[model samples]
Target chain A: MSLSISLAINGQPLDVALDDPRVTLLDLLRERLFLTGTKKGCDRGQCGACTVLVDGRRINSCLALAASLDRAEITTIEGLAEGETLHPVQAAFIAHDGFQCGYCTPGQIMSAVGLILEGHAGDDPERVRELMSGNICRCAAYKGITEAVLEAQKAIADKSGAEQNRRDAA
Target chain B: MNRFDYVRPASVAEAVAAGSEPGSAFLGAGTNLLDLMKVGVARPGRVIDVTRLPGLDRIEWLPDGGVRIGAMVRNSDLAYDERFSRSFPAVAEALLSGASAQLRNAATVGGNLMQHTRCAYFHDLASACNRRVPGSGCDALEGENRLHAVLGWSEHCIATHPSDFCVPLVALDAVVEVEGPHGAREIAIDRLHALPGATPEQETALAPGELIVALRLPADAAAFSRNARYLKLRERTSYAFAVVSAAAMLEVEGGTILRARVALGGVAAKPWRAPEAEAALEGAAPTAQAFAKAAGLALAEAQPSGDNAFKIELARRIVARALTLASEGTPAAMPALPASPFSTKIGANHVA
Candidate 1:
């Protein structure tokens, strides 16, 4: 049985047809939409290589069925940057050398962004490490990854705080 | 994964009716279901998506001052909920200790309770697993059975239930609410999961097509809400299944124990409640010596395999420590312990 789902992907409306109901959000994004920035490591939910933001919440895309996510807003790694300017998380990854092979970088960054937005990435580095344990970096680049997340969290917080202040002044 | 038909029902009645169809399974969060499907363990012909069912995502307070958590409530939301965290600290801590942020965000309370075992043999299709295929033969019995069960395990299957929330829920005396073709019914959380008797495939007591609605915690348990603790001893600090976890709740009055409840995870086929330990702790002084004696009684009948013999001692120690921490009103977090020589031998793979 085929089904049609309407959803917004990275701010763009997408109408997708699923011939098989078992198609995952990760499969649809990578194979159908050609958004390969979200890597698929384990197909199973055990690994967080396919982490994506659905309605501003980080979730394992590999476990989410496309049909079940109708009308949901999805943000992959490709959607992070605006125009040519890199997202603060992307810039922090480069600054901190958070990747040895770059395979798990997209997932790590998405998870970090979600963590910061969820108000979980506090000043404590240990808390950040605990919250980011979902995304695995097999290269053992945890030190760099942890540093990158901390830096990005502060940058994002500062920017949001400034925006709030500007609005308050207005 | 197998080709399947999907139906997203708008109402609880519609969902239950659709779920009553043969070879149809209700889909919630899909964390474990998708993984099992990919591995050829579950082959449902139709999936009834119940996530869209309205009124099933609420966390409301009952009239008795207890809480009713909907089955559709995400693990992350319930863990971070101020009311839930305040009233059920052990449950919240256990929820956080189980999965990572990403998985918790995607996982639902009902889905976590219905998750299958993580026994390597059970996941391997080629291997003989009684839990997977009844009477096929139990491979984990003699082969790499380090993560297998030690308590309440039968010769048919020795797999352990890998839910952190369930341990504390059982200890809290929670009840599960479900709806089906008949009507709505409530089952105690401890009775929801069945021991691996002769039939390992029948893990849960829920009849087929009975949809879990919510879990209700009684108001009488409020006294131990702040005094409860959940201690998980895994291979690493995070994102790992428990080797032996303990959930302890003590109701003390003037330095004397009024009541005690303890449940264990990663030690048996289901959440194993330590009735003997609870009985031993009643009316006793809240001391380390009393906790040690109760902990010993909890593991008195434990039967471990060759590779998992250490879990017996591990479970006992964790129960004692968890009780001590609960008595001291300390939040249950990961405990620091000396390195174990048996960790490597027990296959502590860094999968996550």
Candidate 2:
């Protein structure tokens, strides 16, 4: 049965006519919508290659049925940046050389963003590593990934803090 | 994935009505069900989406001080809820220890309880799995069965339950509430998962078309919040299933153990509760020797189903270690890697 579902993909509202309930969010984004930035390494939930934020929470898009997420605010890798400016996590990945083959970089970066937003890990490298364990880099670039997450989190935190300080002064 | 009729029910009664169909299955986040469908292990003709069901997402604190967690409550939300975690630290730890952060964020409490076993044979379509096909023989009996069940096993099925959340819930005497065509009923967490006896196919106690509405933890269950711990041992430091895990909750006072709740995971088809172990700890001093004795009682009936005899010993040690950690007291803040053996503050010397 064809189903009409509305979603905010990358902050853009889209009314998708899903032909089949079997089409996962990963497939809907990659196949139908042409948002292939979200990789599908393992369609199973085991690998976090399809990590995306639905309502500001990180989840494996491959396992989620597209038909079930009506009106959900979804943020994909393509939605991370504002115009030419790269997201801090995306920039930090480049600065820290957090990827070798770059297959898992998008997922790693997206998961890092979600982790930073969750604010559970703080500045602890160990906690960051543990939290980021979901996004696996077969390239074995964990050291740089961990380093980039710490740096990006600090930068994001500082930027927000400065904004708060400016607001206080005003 | 096989094509199916999609349903979006707005209310619990409507959901139950739609879910009562012969080939209908309730969809909660689809973290596990979708994977099963992709793997061809589960092929339901009708997929009833229950995510939109009303009033099924709140964590209600009863006047009796017990907690009634809505079945649709996301695992991560429950784990991170400050009051919920503080009241049930071990449950929070167990929830954190499961799957991945992404999975926890998407998976629901009801879905976690309803997740199938991760036995390789069960997923392999070529392999004969009695659980998947009732009359079919079990390939796990003679195949590579290193991580198969040790406590509860018939020649029919040797699979073990793959849940961390259930281990602690069973120990703390959690109850499951369900709504069905026949009306509403409750099932104790321990009795929810049936052992793979003559019928491994009947995995749960739920009748066909029954929908789990909520899970409740008794008011007194929070009494052991100060000294409850879940300890999991696996191949990897994080993001892996347990080889042998244990949840230990102790009510200790004046250097003596007043009460204890013990449960084991990755050892049986169900979260195996050891009432004898809890009995052994009562009135005994909280010591390594006492913990060891209780651990021994916990695994007394344990015997190897295959090459996994090591798991029996590992399960015993994990129970002792978990008890030792619980006796020491829960940490003020959750460890970086919840429930991992390496994450605890206690050193190797302290492990009994």
Candidate 3:
């Protein structure tokens, strides 16, 4: 039996048909939709290489079924940047050299964005390291990753703080 | 994953009707179930999606000063909830300690409770495992079992339940509300899992087609909020399962313990509640010596099923450490590394 699901992937509304019920969100993105930015590492939930934002929360897309996510808003690595500008977390990762070989970079950046949005990534590097433990980097780039998350967190905070001030001045 | 007919039920009754079908399995966030299916350990003919059930996603504060948490509540959402964390700090800590942030964000409370053991033999399709296929000889009995159960194990199976969240819930005497084809019923959190006596295949007390609706934390469970802590020992600093874990909660009056609750994880087929150890703590002072005695009593019946004799001593020490931390009181805020032994502070103040 074929199933139909509608979802907003990378802010673009898309309707898809699934002839098989076993298609995971990761496979749906990479194979069917051809949005290959979300990498699949272990295919199991052990690796967070397929991390994506579902309804503004970071989740392992490899573990989630596509049919179960009807009408859900999914943000992948391709959705992080605005036009030519990169998201602060993406910029910070490059500035801090947060990855080597770069296979885990997309998941790391997405997870960091989710962490900051959740307000769990405080100014403390230890908290960032602990919260980002879900995303593994085999290159041993944790030191850089922690630094990048802290910088990006502060950047987002400052930007939001300025926006609040603008509203106050108005 | 094998091909299956997917059904998304709009209501609880519809979900129950669909779930009661033969060879049908309920699918939550699929963090654990999908993984097992990929490994060929689970092959359901029909996949019933219950994530859309309306009332099963709320956290309600009962008028009786207790809390009713829906089974569909995500692990991270429940742990990070300000009011819930303030009241049940140990449970929050245990939730944060189990899986990674991504997995926790997707995993639901009911899914966490229904997660299977992490025994390597059970997941290896080539290995013989009674829990996977009944009447098959247990391969873990003579395999790599350095982390198997030591407290409750028969020759048939030696696997330990791998949930960190259940440890504190069992200590708090939480109640599980379930609905099935028969009707609605409640099971004490401690009795939800079964010991591997002769039927290792029967992991939980849940009957066929039964779905966990919600979990209730009784009014009295909050009484230990001032003195509750969950401590876990892991193979790594983070993102690892517990080698041994303990949850200790005490009600101290005038420097003497009025009531005590202690439970252990990663040591048995289910979350092990040490009633004898808790009884030993009553009317006694909250001292390290007293904690040591209680810890010894907690592991008195523990025996190594394989080359894991060191787990017994380790479990005992962790129990005493958890008790000491509980007596010191919960931290004003959760630590950076929640529930890890390295996050221990000598003098943590109680949450106000």
Candidate 4:
């Protein structure tokens, strides 16, 4: 038996028949929708290569069953960009030379977005490293990743007035 | 991942009913379960998610002074909640130390208590594990067993419960409140997990359809809030599993010890509470020598295996340090140790 589920992927409606319960949402995204931007690292969920934002929180997509995530809004790296402009986190990653192989870039950016949005971005490099521990970039360019997240945090904080008004209205 | 029928229930009763299905399992925090499934370690026929249940995440302070933390309360929420931080600091510390930030955001208190062991043999399909397969022999006994349990281990299984949270919770005299096909009942935290005397597969006292609703910490723990810490030793300073750890709460009145509670992790199949150490602390002066003596008494009963004998010494030092730290007030953040290399090498190193 197949389960019919609807998800907003990258701001587009994704309605599909998830017939195989064994299939992870990561697998469904990569193999079926051809959204292979989310890399598959340590498929056992040890690494955060498959991290995605379900609604607003960062979740490991490898652990989620497509059938169980009915009507959930999901955001991957593909969703972070608006037309041609990169998300601030992505732009910062580039500016900070935040990656080497770039295989784990999508997850690193996704996690940093959630971290900054949740106000976990702090002044200390150690704090940044600890909070971003979930995403493992095998390229071992963590120093750059940590710096990018912190720098993006300062830039975002500078525009806090507009965001605060938006939040207050909501 | 194995094919499984999925059910999302809005109520505890509905969740318990779904567990009546032949091979169905609860799916609150899917970190452990789904990961096991993807790696071909677990293949449940069905899964029932109790995450969305309304009252399941509530942490209600009872009129009796105790707190009832709903099973669905996220680990991050549990750790940061002001009530938890004030009333039970060790529980909060344990919660924070258990996993990485991403996982803590998703992991629940009930799921932390119900996590399975991380035996290398169990994770690797090439090796036999009794916990994974009913009749299969456990290869960990004679195989690479540095992470395996050194205490309360049967000849069959030697894996320790991989949670950093359970040890402190059990020591704090917490009770597990569960609802099942039958009415609700409470079990002591210590009794919630079963020792692997013979049947290593039976890890928990939870029945087939019993669902853990909340864990209740005794009201008296608040009195000892001044002197409590969850000290962990890990392969890495962060996002790492405990190698040998101690959770201690020492109550000193005037210049003498009024009471002490100690429990150990990373050394046993179950959370090991040291009543002997607590007895040693009674009527003792608040001194480093006194703490050292109490720690020695705590390890008196420890039966360490060949490679893990260092754990006894490590645990002793940890308990002493905990008592010493508690003598001071709430400590500053623990200094991060130099994280060791990520190794595929399997051996018990007392480096931490």
In candidate 4, stretches whose alpha carbon ends up further than 4 angstroms from where it belongs are A162-170, B332-352
TM-score of chain A of each: 0.96, 0.98, 0.98, 0.91
Docking class of 3: medium
**Which parts of model 1 are misplaced by more than 4 Å?**
B332-352
Candidate 1 CA-lDDT value: 0.87
lDDT of 3 by residue, B1-352 (tens): 7889999998878888889988999999999999999988999999999898999999999999899999999999999999899899999999999889999999999999999999999999999999989999899999899999999899999999999999999999899999999999999999999999889999999988899999999988889989999999998878888899999999999999999999999999999999999999999999999999999999999999998999999999999999999999988988888998877442221111
Report fnat in order of the candidates: 0.78, 0.79, 0.81, 0.48
DockQ of each: 0.59, 0.65, 0.64, 0.43
In the order shown, the candidates' Cα RMSDs to the true structure are 3.9, 2.0, 2.5, 4.5
2 against 4, candidate with superior TM-score: 2
Worst 10 residues of 2 chain B by lDDT: B343-352
In model 2 chain A, the worst 10-residue window by lDDT is A122-131
TM-score of chain B of each: 0.93, 0.97, 0.97, 0.92
Q: Give the lDDT of residue A94 in candidate 3.
A: 95
Q: Summarize candidate 1's per-residue lDDT along A1-170 as a digit string, tens digits.
A: 78999999999998998888878999999999999999999877666889999999999999999999999999999999999999999999999899999998899999998998998546666667778889989998898888888898899889999999999999
TM-score of each: 0.95, 0.98, 0.98, 0.92
Model 1 per-residue lDDT tens digits across residues B1-352: 8878888989888988888889998999999888888988889998999988999899999998999999999999998898787788888878988878999998999899888999889899999998899999888988999878999989899999999999989988899999998888999999999898899999999887899999999987777875888888888878888999998999999989999999899999899999999999999999999999999999999988648999999999999988987897844332211112122221232232
Candidate 2: true interface contacts recovered? 0.79
The per-residue C-alpha lDDT of model 2 at residue A115 equals: 96
